[model samples]
Every structure is written in structure tokens, then in C-alpha cells.
Target: MWFKNLVLYRFSQDTDITAELLEEGLSHQPFRPCGKTELSSYGWISPVPGGDTLVHQSGSFLSLSAKKEERILPASVVKDAVNQKVEHIEAEQGRKVFKKEKDQIKDETTLDLLPRAFTRSNITRAYIDTRGGWLIVDASSFRKAEELTSTLRSSLGSLPVVPPALKQSPAATMTQWLEQHAATLPSSMTLGDECELKDLGEDGGTIRCKHHDVLADEIINHLNTGMQVSKLAIHWNEALSCIVGDDFLIRRVKFTDTLQEQSEALNAEDEASRYDADFTLMAGTLGEFLKELITVMGGEEEKEAAGWETKATVTVEEGVEEDAPF
Candidate 1:
């Protein structure tokens, strides 16, 4: 386990103090003139598991499937769940505040008093600990810790100032995150819908969609022989770890989960069918295949967009009924 803590301090004045001149420095406007200083510059993994953790997920998988098939619940229920998620975030982030003070003191022996000291700004301190799991000690005695807090943001780009609503796990690490906190969620998503979005390869940009069940076949027969399905999936997962489903953040999703229904759709060429987990298709040439993938995925438009040439200008929302057409 590793722990990283950051502390930044700001001062009101930059002057040295001596015991004898304490009173004089305090009483005097300018303590002995100090030499001018140069312009100051400011400076700045895991594995599968066993036991209850695994068992609980297995049960959860079945339970969630049953719940999902329970007619999508009422709009009110879905709204309540979303509202609860927001409130939870607000409570965790809450607010950061701090206090500052100064006092006067005189050196009895030297017959001198020290001037009052001032603390201009506040310092923010954060503690991150990872053992069996991970926890963040986000309390700060200083005010205005946003910048310092953001410094902790990884190159991957996930905003971690606030506690992550999604717990960290192997299989569910990311899925858990999207379900609980994704802002612009894809609606009409089925219980088993699974989409893998990615931003990688050539120009460091690429998108591809293949039938979920035919995933093995499609990957094996992709028009481009250079790309590997499993490798693409791994990259997509890594990038999403940092994006964290924010509205301003545009995510490139890759549709990966290939289900039995999805396989059938490609055979029948159903464009709107949904794959098991509602994964979006890669854009362009890949999108056509994505459309077919959707047929079995479920929760797609009846006939897809009339002008649906590619996978742009489209969005899926929460609690929406099955859309897209074959």
C-alpha cells in the first residue's frame, strides 16, 4: 500500500526574527531593512479475487438482472436513484474552510517584543491510503484547496478531488463507476448491454464496433488485421479510468460485449438491436457493424437515424425505452 500526502503553505510576510528585536520589530513599521530578494517562483493495480467479494458479485449479477427485467422500475425510482447519487457526492466533497490568527509576545530578558505574525492564505493537506482497499483523508485546515487538490489528478485525467462514488474492483471497477456516476448515460440500455469505448491507435485515435457474440470472429476478421480485439479493450478500459463520466468530458466508447442476441442481429442485420450491455459502436466504417451490434444489444432506435451514416450526433439517455430499428 502507498500513501501520498500534499501540503502547501503561504505566508503574509517574508522576514527573519530575532529574540532581542521582538518588541522593536513589533512596534516599528519596518523592522531593520532586509536585502531585496530575487523574484520568488512557486514550486508544485490489482487482480481477480475470491471469497464473499466474488460471491456477492455473482449474487448481485443475478439480482440486478432480475431487477433490470423488472420493467425498468418507475421513472420516479430511477430519478430517486440519480438524485441520491448527486446528494452523496455533495456530502462527500462538502466544503473546505480554515482559520488564521496572530499574537504578541515580549522577551522579558531582552526587553523586546516580537511583532505579530500573519498567515495570508490557507494550506490544503490530503492523504490517500491504499491497503486491502483504498480511502482518502480529504480534510483540510486551510481554505482554497481546490488547486492543490487538483494537483493530485493523474495524467490519465480522472478528477479525484472528490471521493470516487464507484468502488475499486477488478471486473466491476469501471462498470461500477459508470452505473453510479456517469452523467450522460446511454438510456435504453439492457441489463446485459456491454459497450467498450476507446481512444487509441493511429493518430492515437480509432473506433471499431463488432458483433458481441461474433466478437471472436469479428476481431479475427476485422477489415484491418493490425488491431487486436483484446488489446483494444484493454486500452479503452485504461482511458475511461481517468475520464470519470463528466458532462464536459467527451468519452470515446467501444462496444465490446457480444451476446447471443447480438450475434443473431448481425445475421438478420438488425441495426437497432442492443448488445448485452448497450455498448456504443465505434464511429464510421466501424459504426455500421455497431448498428448491427445494437440489434441484439436491445434498447436502440427503431430503424436507427434515417441519415445515420455514422455514430455521431446521437445520444442515449436514462430510463428511455428501447429505440433504434432493424
Candidate 2:
């Protein structure tokens, strides 16, 4: 119900997204357990446990989950098996095992070990804000978020979604905020205890501060030395706190006790009801917060006109008789 991190993607205006369309598209790739010898399997799943639907709707928000099952096979174990086989073959035949044969042995070893490997499953939850045409993923890194998006893209054929673009860079805006010590910041946002600064030089260095004042003299001295803020921690209207990175990543998100208490006050009788209600509240709150953030950063960057095409060149081999009739 709660997300610890946020990775945002905005859908194009032309994309006709809806709950029914998502449910149908996602049905084509429902969650399946990993098969033997397969490294991983990813597909859509229900966000609520014991729920049958792939898409959970709460007002304009559509919740979705992607489950990934992966087999754990140690590389060292495969390498040791390959090496032992190579040594045995070389000793018995009195000949060196070349790279090609050794590689084959490694592949065989890996396949042989895969059946015995332990399997683990992980679920990544995300929601589409239909009102804003935004896809918000609960992931710590872009790689993890992309895994879910990639699967969703494959399911839907093509997904016209891209990361949020801002008119002003987060680093420069945050640096200016620190320089003015909350004077230039919006009334809804205030400085938190953590920050990360980097030197804008060939041999760049990083300084990360936690549990220290971001506007303290020591930190200001570093800034005076031409260091720029790469990440800054901030509290948003006393409802949420998170670290916003220059790369547009929101990390370490914590919802305030007030928000939680409000959710708890709903007093749902079952897990499904509670999840739905809590998600609705969270999505509504975050929608407003993100809008305020976008405004504070001077609004979103203008996107290019749609339906542009790039010309591609193909080179055929001189010896090949292109699609010759037999």
C-alpha cells in the first residue's frame, strides 16, 4: 500500500489508456512460475493478495503489480564444475581442452545445476495515474523499474511513456535553494537533514551528509568551493519526506504519521478493502504534491511534436543474392 521509493514516467497525451485496456493487455502475460533452466520469468500480477483482477482501480488510479521469479545458481559452483570436467578430460585424453570445448562444458555445467537451484519471487508494485497520464513505480533504482515497464510494454505492444522532464534541472534549483536557506523555496517545502554535493570538476568528488543541517556553515563552505547539490532531502507540507536526486529519482520516501492515522481511521474489515482505500488516499496526496513540485520547478519541459520518423539505411552483403528465387 505504501511505496518507499518512486520512479516516475509520463505517458504521452495520445496514449488512450484505461483500466479495461490495461486489464486485457496484462492478461496476455499473467504471472507464471519460473521453469527449469530459465533464469527468470516476469509478468503481471494482482496487487492485492487473493484478488483475481490484474488491475485494481481506485478513482482515477489504476494499480498494477509485476512479479519476477528467478533461479539462484552460484557462478562459482558452475565454474568449479566446468574446471573439474576440463581437468578430467585433459588428464584422460592427454590433450588440452581449447576455449570452444571449455565453453561448451561451462554451458553444460550451468544447465545441469539449474534444476537444483533455488527460486525466489519478487513483486514490484506500480500505479497509473489516469488523470495525469503518469506511471509511478515503487522501486529504488531505474533498473528495477524498467523491468516492470519492459514487461508491461511487451504486453501492450508499445508504451508511449517517458520520464518526467522539467524546465529547470534539479541540481541547479536545489543548489540555489540551499544558497538562500529556504528563502527562495516554496512555502510548502522545507529543508531536511540529508544532502549530497558533488564537485563539478574533471576529478569530481562527492560529499554526503546525514543528520546534519544542509544550510550549516560547513556545508555552505563546500558549496562555496563550487560543489553542486546532486541530491537533497526535503519535507513536503509535513505530509511526506524524501530525497530528490538530480536524475529525477525520489528516494527513501516516508509518509507522516498523520497520513497513516488517517488511513487507519478508515477501519476496513478486510485486507482488500484496506489496500484499496489506502492506495486511493496515497495517490491523491502524491498527485497534489507532484503538481506543486512541477510548478515550483518552473513547470514541465515542452515535448516535441508527435509522429516523427527517422530514416534508416540497410547495407546488404555484396556476395548475397538478395532474396533470390530458388
Candidate 3:
């Protein structure tokens, strides 16, 4: 499956857990439906639905899925029920219910309606590169990524992974790039038409641009005025493209069709074989891309802190799972 957004994490220490062990550990928290009176439930699920295996592995790459089920109870319905209950209590007591009593009634109403609530489900896909000691999640936002990591930690007992934080800020580096001539950029990098700049002062004003050369005098003047580049879109090596944030998160990734053709040409006889081939190709390409990105951003010092690092990289070129939850 292709990852839309990357939330990279570096392993805190060397982990010796094997695929078999991971599968065993995850089996303990296999996905289950939401229970009565429960607002939500989260657990592990098969990376390939209908497949018996929970952990899908292609070489050193391991893929997994976390499923979350949340009950959909409309707030209006709950409020109406609570109001009715409050009225009944007030009539019984021959007086209006106190604020405390009304709050309790609201809580009770929610609990009563939860079991009958319809459920909405979402699945978050994640992969680990055992050799590279990285965890990559296909979540567009940090909150979603954190949810996936939290579920992983709960299942595995301990997952010491954190987001990458560099000593040299990307914002400052990007600001410098914008203030300079286009010829000064890395040989493999070309600025795209979109960017986000933020003021460095306490007000923290932000500006976003599209379809405009970021190196223009107007943009440079803002940088001269202490506005730092917070996000930038760039084409790398004429093969990969993405919007990279100051925090090192990469989103809206697009790879050339050459990579797609290679994936389609993979002639695996079985589902497992096809999966392996896809992961290998995608990971190899992305791994190289990330290596270059880290080098350009100024290499970060290795640490045991909670942060993420690029492991084996994969892209949408692997083909999307028809059942993927976006």
C-alpha cells in the first residue's frame, strides 16, 4: 500500500524482535468491535484483510495496520435525551435540577445511547524497517500518527520511537535558500511554485504562496524582515516531489511514472510475492530520497530521544489497497 503522508520515528535502541514475535505480540490486541457503552476501541488488524497474517513482511520491511472503531452518537440526540431526563427529574423532585444534577443526567444519557450508536471505522497503516530502525506511518497529521504509535506501544508493551528534531532548523535553512539566487540550491533540488513563510516575531504571522517564484524580491524582502520559511515544495532528482515542513515532515508526495511502471511490471505469481516485490522497489527509491534530504538539511545527531528517522521508503507506486481507509 502507498503512504500519503509520512510520520517518521527513530528507534531508541536496537530491537531484536522478529516478524514472528511481532505477529505474536500483535495477536494479543487483534481488532475487536466497539463494546456496549464504549465510545471507541483500537487494536491491530491484518495488513491484508482476509489474510491470516497480521504482519506483512517483504525482506526487512514489515507492514501493519491499526483499526479504530468509534461510535457515532449525534450530540443533538444526546442533548435532547439529557434534557428530557432533566425535566423528568425536576418534576419528580418538584423543582428544577441543579447544574450538577443536570451534568450527571447528561453523562447518564450518553452512556445509555452509546450501545445503540452507529459505528464509524478507520484504519491507519504503518511500517517498520527493522534494519534501519525506523517507523513510518501513513498519517497526514501528527495527532493521527500519535494515535497509531500509541496503539503500537500498547500492543508491544514498549516502543521507544520519537520524531526527528534537527539541531539546524529547516526554517532557517529554507529562509537562506529563498534569500539567495536559484543557482545556489543543491544540484538535485529545484524550488517548486508553492511555499509557506512565517514571521519570526511574537505575532507569528504566516504567508502562503502558490504558482509564484519564491525567490522573487517580494518574498526575499519578507525573509530580510525576519520571516522564516516554514514549508517549501521542491522537486528532488527530477524523480520525486513533496512538500517538506520545517519539522522535517514530508507530505503530498509524488513520484515519476517510471517508478510506477517498474511496480506494474513486477511479475509475482502470488499475493505475498507481489507484496514483497512492491515493498522492495518502493523502499529502495524512498530510502535514497530520504538520505539525500537528511544530508541537505544538515545531518542530525543520533539520539535515544523520542523522534523519527527515515527507514526503508515506500511510495504510492506500490499500488493502493482497494480497501484502504484513505
Candidate 4:
């Protein structure tokens, strides 16, 4: 499966964790269908469907998928049912149902309707670079990514991971790149046709452009007016294209046809083999791209910024109890 977005997190270099241990920890929270009256449920699932392996492994790269099931219950339907029950109780007892009684009736009605509610299922994919101490989630939303990490933390009893924060602000860098055109922009990256610029001040406002020259005078004027580049689309290293946000999230990722052709030439025989090949190819390429992008952003230093703390490094600790309840 291809990832449309990435939420990157870095772990301390000293942190040690083995693939086998990760698999064991995740097995504690294996996917289970929602209960009769449950509105939502979440748990880990096999990255490769039908495979007994909870963690899909290829070299030091490990992948897993989290499944979430949510039941659909309309508020109007529940409210209507609650009102009908309230009316029936009032008629039978010949007294008006008070707020407390109405609240109890609503709870009862919700429980009765829950089992019959239709459910929708979704899966979020995440990969762990054991060698690199990186956890990359294929989620566009921060909340969804946090959910996956939260479950992992609960299962493992500890998780030392945090989002990447560069020393220099990406918004400032992007704004400078647009203002200076090819001069300030990294040689390996070129501006694409889409971008988003926001004012640095409280009421500075925002602007979005599509299929327009990012280096045009009109766009430059906004950047000149103290608006910072919060998001910009760029083609990097001539292999991948994506919209990079100020928060460092990459979205709408697309690999060039040349990369796809190279992958096709490999011609893996089975599903598992193909998955391994694809994962390796993607991880290797993106790993390099990320390194270059970091360098472009003036490289990561040892300094810790506010709100960005290095928790436990992903290292193996001996004699520790691994048998924590899920």
C-alpha cells in the first residue's frame, strides 16, 4: 500500500528496541471487533491482511496497521426515540418527566439503538525504522497519528518519540525561497504550482495559490508584506513531489514515474515479496530525501527546543518486565 502523507517522529539515538519485542508488545492489543453496545474500538492489526505476523518486517524496517471501528448513530434519531419514550412514560404515569428522568430515558434509548447502528472501519498504517529510531505514520492528521502512538505507548508501557522540529522556521525559509527564487531555494528542490502563505501578525490573514507561479510578483508582494510561507508544494530530488507544511508534515506525496518503472523492473513474484521490495525502496529513498531536506533546513543540532523533549531512546533494557497488561 502507498502512503499519501507522513507524520515523522524521531527517537533518541541511544534508544534500543528490537523487532521481535515490538511484535510481542503489539500482539497484546490485537484487533477485535466492536462490542454490541460499543460506539468505537481501536487496536493493532496485521499490515498484510491474512498474515499471522503482527509486525511486517523487512530488514530493519517494520510496519504495522491500526484498525478503528466506529458505529454510526444519528443524534436526531436518538433524540426522537428519547422523546417518544419520555412521552410514553409521562402518559402511563400521568406526570411530566423531569430533566433527570428525561436524561435516564436518553441513556436507555442510546443503549437500545447502539447494537443496531452501522459501523465504519478505518486503518492507519505506521512504520518503525528500528535502525534510524524513527516512527513514520501514514496519517495526514496529527490527532490520528497521536492515537496510534498513544496505543503503542499503552501496550509497551513506554514510548520515547516526538515530532521533528528544525532549528530554523520552515515558514521563514519558504518565504525567503519564494522571494529569492532559485537563489535561496535548495538546488535539489524546486517550487511547484501550489502554495499557502499566512500573515505572521494576528490579523495578517492567509492566501492559497494553485497552478500559479510561486515566484510571481503578486505572490512575492504578499511575502514582502510580512506574510510567512506556512506551506509550499515542491518537487524534491527529481524523484518525489509533495506539499511540505510549516509543521514539517508532508502530504499528497507522489513518486515520479521513473521510480515506479524501476520498481516494476524488479518484478517481485508474490504479494509478500512485492511488499518487501516496495517497502525497502520507499524507505531507502525517503530516508535519503529527509536527510537532504534536513540539511537544507540547516541540519538538526543537539539543542532541545521548547515543547520538544527527548524521552527514552529506543534502546533495549535488560531484566525489564515485558509482561505489562494491555
Candidate 5:
């Protein structure tokens, strides 16, 4: 810390000020940083030749005592203190934003603040107080939170007005209608200006979307189908060829819902899983009716099988015998 205490005696290059001890090394003192000092004692040493010899003036040395413990903060503390230490600045920025005032500061270009105090990382959500102290934000500590509460009201409290058409019509879904007809939904809608989509240049379209392009189609299809939820089976080997839609969402659809007791109708060990779902409607009602008909007819019996017992048909007419030659 010798350098910390070491005084810098620069030649005071200002025209308006001059005093003692400012000339520390030359023995002829000059200007000072703090205050004027008495010219306590003076002595003149004359040069041999000149008309008036130069005077070597001296006095009590003016002291400029440094008040700080160190001239500069250590590098690491500087990095952290500016980051977390300033609370007053944070209070100002957050408070003014709540009121509809023109005076407001954004906490941009800085990292999100952390809990430490006075680490001056460029990343900031902070400001400087009148005393030059940094004020930081503590997200976990609700110290100055009355201000944040009202400002946060604009986050989730309001709902967008779905068009009277979307709300009233039972046929069109929220996703489909929004896709084909956003212009009629509302005009310049806003959550206090936070959520409004950015307008592109004159000829271009709006640059934001409520959801991904692909997601809107998928969700619309799910809502339209008979309102039956697709069942997801966790067991893999128990799976049938019944995966639906595409990729992972697909699964076998069967008509029978109850766990059926094993019988000739469902012979294979793999077919046991078909009993897990209801095959009744799936046969002809809903799930893949055309495909199910093909599977039932694929059996070697080829002809239409008898209906579930007791519906035996009476003979329409006895078959006439063809004569054979001996």
C-alpha cells in the first residue's frame, strides 16, 4: 500500500492557484489541493551574481491525508459490489415504472442481479444514489416490493377478448379461428404495451405468433375428434399396430374396453392386448372402422361367420341334387 499512500506531486498547471509544499522537491513550494498554509518560516539563499538572489522559502508542509482505507477497490469486490450492493437505485427504477410517468429507467445491457452487494458487473438492474452508493435488487427479498406488485398486475391479470364469433360459435375452436381470422379478434390489443406484437415495416406482416405454426393444427385436430382422449400405454411389448397420428403419439385403438377372458375369438398371446380396449365401437363405430372390417375378413374362413350364437338361419330352400352317371 506504499503506492496507495504515496502522494502525487504534480506541477499544478492551473493559472489561478499557487502556494507552498506544491514545490516539495525544488525547496520553493507552490499550489495546494486542500487549503492555504501559513508561511511559518522563511530563508533566502542569494546567488553570487544576480541583482536580487533567489529565495529558498520553506513552511509547515501542507498535508493531503487520504480518508479511504485504500485508494482503489480490489478487482473481485468491484465485480461483485456493483452487481448486488445498490438497493436505492433499484427502488427508484421500479417505483417510477408503476406510475404512468415519463421518467423511467430500464435495467438493460446488464446481467440479472444476484444477492451479493457492490459487485459492479456490467450486467445490472441497478442505479446510483445521491450519495454515489449503488442500489441493487434482491428478487427473493421483498424489501421494496410494494412497487413491484402493481406493476406486475399487467402480467397475467387480463385476458384477450376472443371475437364474438369465436366465443359464440360452438363449431370453430379457439386455435382454428385465431389462425384464419385474427384481424377481427381485436384492434391493437395490449397488456399495458408489454405483450403487443411488433409491427414490421409498411408492406410486411406482424413478426410474432401466439403459438408455433405446427402446434395450431395439431391442437385443432385433437379437439375435433369425438372428444375421446387417446390412451397412452406405458408397456412396450404389450403394444399392437395401433400407434396413432404419427411418430410417438400413435397407439393401437381397440373397440373392447374390458380385460377380456381368453377365448378363441382372440387366440394369439399378442392379441390379449386387444382385449384391453373396447372393440365394440372400434368394430364399426369409431376407431378405424374400414381397417377393422378388412382384419376380420382376412381370416381363412373367408365367408361371413355366424353372428354371436343363437341367430342361426333357417334354410331358404333345400339344395337340389345333381344326377350322376354310373
Candidate 6:
């Protein structure tokens, strides 16, 4: 399956791992449905439904999926049940139910409802680029990406990775790009039809536009009025298009029709073959796009920052890893 969104992370350059090794590590906590009384369950699962393998290898990329099943017991329902029990007890015993009893009743209600409550399940897919030292997740939510990384760390005992940080903040760079009217963008980069602009103040207003020309005078007027571009749609090298946000998260990713047609030319006869063909093409192109993206954003940050650490360059004599090139 193609990834609709991307939340990218960087792994240490020296972090050596193989598909078999990753599969063995993930096997420590395989997916299992939530038990009758359990409220939730989280574990590793095959990216392909009904597949037995935990790690699916396609050339240099390794795909993994995390499954999370949660029981849906609304707080309002629990409160209603607890209130009913509290009222019945007070009415029959002729005594007011205090906070302690009310809390106990609430807990009891939750446990009683847990077994019968409906459940919802979702799968988060991600791929590890061993060659480029990147972990690319197909989730728009940062929280979901962190959850997958957390589970991976728990399973493997340690995972040294951090989000890609750039020397120039995305907001500042995008703001400048908008001010320039897309005339100074890097090679093969072009403005799209959507953008989000917001004032700099803490409580300032935000403006979102879609199907509107970003270089039009109307949008430029907002820039002249001190609003900054927080999110912008851009097409990269004719391969894919996505909206890059100030938070450095890429959303609304779509591979170009030409690229899709190229993958289709493979003429895969089975599901596995088709998946492998598509992924191989997607990962190969995405890797190149990221390198140019990092360059256009003023390259990766050189030092450690508040929320992330840059991979350090180490010498072979020290038996340490080199800094990630991209």
C-alpha cells in the first residue's frame, strides 16, 4: 500500500539491523486481540493482512506494522451507570454516597462494561531504510508515530532515532518562499494550490486556502501583512506532491500519475510481487526526494536541538557511527 502521509525520523548511521533480526525482535510481542476484560492491546503485526511474517523486506527497505485495539466505553455511559448505582444505594440505604463510594462505583461500572463494549482497531505502517538510515512512518499523527517507535524500542531493548531537524526552521523558510513568489525555489520544486498562513502572535488568527494560487496577489497580500506560511503544498521533481508543515510533518502525499504508471508497467502477477514492485519504486524515489528536500531546507541541523539530536560524525578508530548524510 502507498503511504498517504509521512512522519520521517533518522536512525544512527551505524545502527546495523537485518530483516531476520528485526523479525526475531518483534516476535517478542506479536499481535493478539484484546482480552475480555482488557481495555486495550498493542503489539506487532504483519503489514499484509493474514501474513505470518512480521517484517516484509523489499530491497533495502523493511516494512513493519503496529496494531492497536481499544475497547470503546464512553465516559458518559460509565458516568450514567455509576450515577444510577449511587442513587439506588442512597435511596435504599437512606444515606448519601460520598466521593469514595462514587469512585468505587465508577471503577466497578468500567470493569463491568469492558467485556461487552465495542472495540476499534487500527494499523500503523512504517518502513526502515537501512541504507539511508531513516524511519519513515505513514501516519499523519505524531502521537501515533511515537507510539510505534515506543513499541519498537520496547521490543528491541533500544532504538536510537530522532526526527529530522533542519538548520533553517520550516516556517521561516516557507515564509520566505512565499514572499519570493516561488521564483527562487530549488530545482524541480514548484508551488501547489493550497497554503496555510498565520500571524506570529500566540493567539493570532490563521488563514487556510485551497485551490487558490499561492503566487496570486491576494495570497501575497497576507504575506505583506506579516502573516507567515505555516503549511504549503509543493510538488517535488515530478515524482510526488505533499504539504509540508511548519512542524516538519509532510501530509497529503500523492505519487504522480507518471510514477504510478511506471510501477504498473511491472505487470506483477501476485499480491506479494505487486507490493514488492510498488514499494521498491516508492522507497527508491522517496529517498532521493528527501535528500533534495533537506538541501532546500538549508540542510540538516549541525548540532543537537531542543527536541532532537543530530547524528554525530565519528571516526572508524572510535568504532562509532558516522553522521547521516541526508
- lDDT (C-alpha, whole model) for all candidates: 0.24, 0.84, 0.77, 0.80, 0.22, 0.84
Candidate 3 lDDT by residue in tens digits, 211-256:
8888888998888888889889889887778888776777777877
TM-score of each: 0.17, 0.92, 0.87, 0.91, 0.13, 0.91
**Which stretch of 10 consecutive residues in model 5 shows the poorest summed lDDT?**
1-10
Where in model 5 is the C-alpha error above 4 Å?
Answer: 1-147, 150-183, 186-211, 214-216, 225-326
Cα lDDT for residue 139, model 6? Answer: 78
Report the C-alpha lDDT of model 2 over 1-326, residue by residue, as the tens digit: 69878888887554567889999999999989988889889998899878999999988899999999999998888988999999999999999999999999998888888889999998899999988878898987777888788888888877767777787899988898888887977888999999999999999998999899999999989989999999889999889999888887788889999998899999988999999878998999899989988787677876654332222111111221213110
Runs with alpha carbons beyond 4 Å of true place in candidate 6: 303-326
The TM-score that candidate 2 achieves is: 0.92
Quote the positional error of residue 176 for candidate 4 in Å: 1.4
Tell me the tens digit of each residue's lDDT in model 5 across 54-133.
Answer: 21111211111111111223446544544443444557666422322211212220222222223221110111111211
Clashing pairs in 6: none
- How would you encode candidate 4's per-residue C-alpha lDDT over 1-326 as one tens digit per residue? 76778888887544577778888999999989889999999999888757778888888788889999999999999999998988898899899899998888888889999999999999999888877768998877677777788899888888887666577888877777788785865678888999998887877787888889988999989877889888888898878999888778778789888876777789988887777777778887788888888777766656354354556523211211113110
User: Which residue pairs show collisions in model 4?
Assistant: 15-313, 15-314, 15-315, 16-314, 16-315, 16-316
Expressed as tens digits, the lDDT of each residue in 1-326 for candidate 1 is 01112111111122122222322321222112211221111112000111111001111110000000011124464445445545565679794222211111111211121112111222222222211111122122112233323332221123222221212221232333233433322442322122333333555443334335323344334323443221112123211111112111112233344422444455532322322122222112122322332232232322233223221121112211113110
**Cα lDDT of model 6 by residue, 98-200, tens digit:** 9998998888899999999999999889999998889898877677777788888888877778777688899889988888877668879998999999899
How far off is residue 197 in model 2, in Å? 0.2
What lDDT does candidate 3 reach at residue 154? 71
- Candidate 2 vs candidate 5: the TM-score winner is 2
Model 6, TM vs. native: 0.91
Candidate 1: C-alpha RMSD after superposition? 26.8
Q: Which regions of candidate 2 deviate over 4 angstroms?
A: 305-326
Judge candidate 2 at residue 7 and give its lDDT. Answer: 85
